[model samples]
Target: MVTRARRNETDPDLGVLAGRLLFAVQNELFTSLAKEGFDDLHPRHGAVLAYLDEGGVRATELARLSGQHKQVVGTMIDELEALGYVERKPDPADRRAKLVCPTARGLAQARAADKIMSAIQERHARRIGRDTFTMFKAALIDVTDHQRRQQPQ
Candidate 1:
């Protein structure tokens, strides 16, 4: 059996490293959120919650921002609505369009998530030095942007 210690002998590929980082951070964030009375939320909900704003956002925009298909985003919206995290309302600019507006509970969750993420980043920055952490973030963003640009339109 290949022990985890033995696996560390070789450098991980970019995807593995990225997945590890993502899942680790998500685990910490969700666990903390659950402790704070948001036990109903899961990591998948981030596709919708991450882009929500007070002014309300269109479901199509959420799909675009989240890189999810419109149908998937629509389903997520339905789930969030059922959970009392959001509501569908008429768009002020377009009567034919519906806007997804965050509920008070959703806003509270967003606030908590922001605080938690900030603390997590701060902890990592302190460990690696703020300047290095900043550089790392910039490099990561560059890599991600390059990858996105490479995708077929």
Candidate 2:
């Protein structure tokens, strides 16, 4: 048996609730970054930043991982490069290809984002018991892993 919250009044679909929670978390992260003087950063930038590898990644690979168009990723990379967050260097393996790598400022921002995410997770654990939150996260991972395994490569 499920009980509805007074504010929500009714139960939301699981996917809808998940999406809302994700957006809320992202909004809070962006707000925190803005307060810390990263005012120019936007939620859309996460598409590129989140999937970036430590060494570097090719623009086309980044676009595929980010589920964004190649041109769009290229533009975002250009903006990030201008902002001193990332750099484009010629890929050693491919003379004509370029790899996007994070700069010192970008690494700092990544650290800050990690801290913010940890704080958010701690808050959620406190709100819904640590054990429950752990189980919930594990369940989500399992579901995603299962879906990934089922997909054709």
Q: Judging by TM-score against the true structure, name the best candidate.
A: 1
Give residue 42's error in model 1 in angstroms. Answer: 0.7
Q: Tell me how far the alpha carbon of residue 52 in candidate 1 is from the true structure, in angstroms, after superposition.
A: 0.6
- Clash totals, every prediction: 0, 0
**lDDT of all predictions, in order shown?**
0.93, 0.85
Where does candidate 2 stray beyond 4 Å? 1-9, 145-153
Q: For every model shown, what is its TM-score relative to the native structure?
A: 0.92, 0.79
TM-score of 2: 0.79
lDDT of 1 by residue, 128-151 (tens): 999999999999999988887787
Model 2 has how many clashing residue pairs? Answer: 0
lDDT score, candidate 1: 0.93
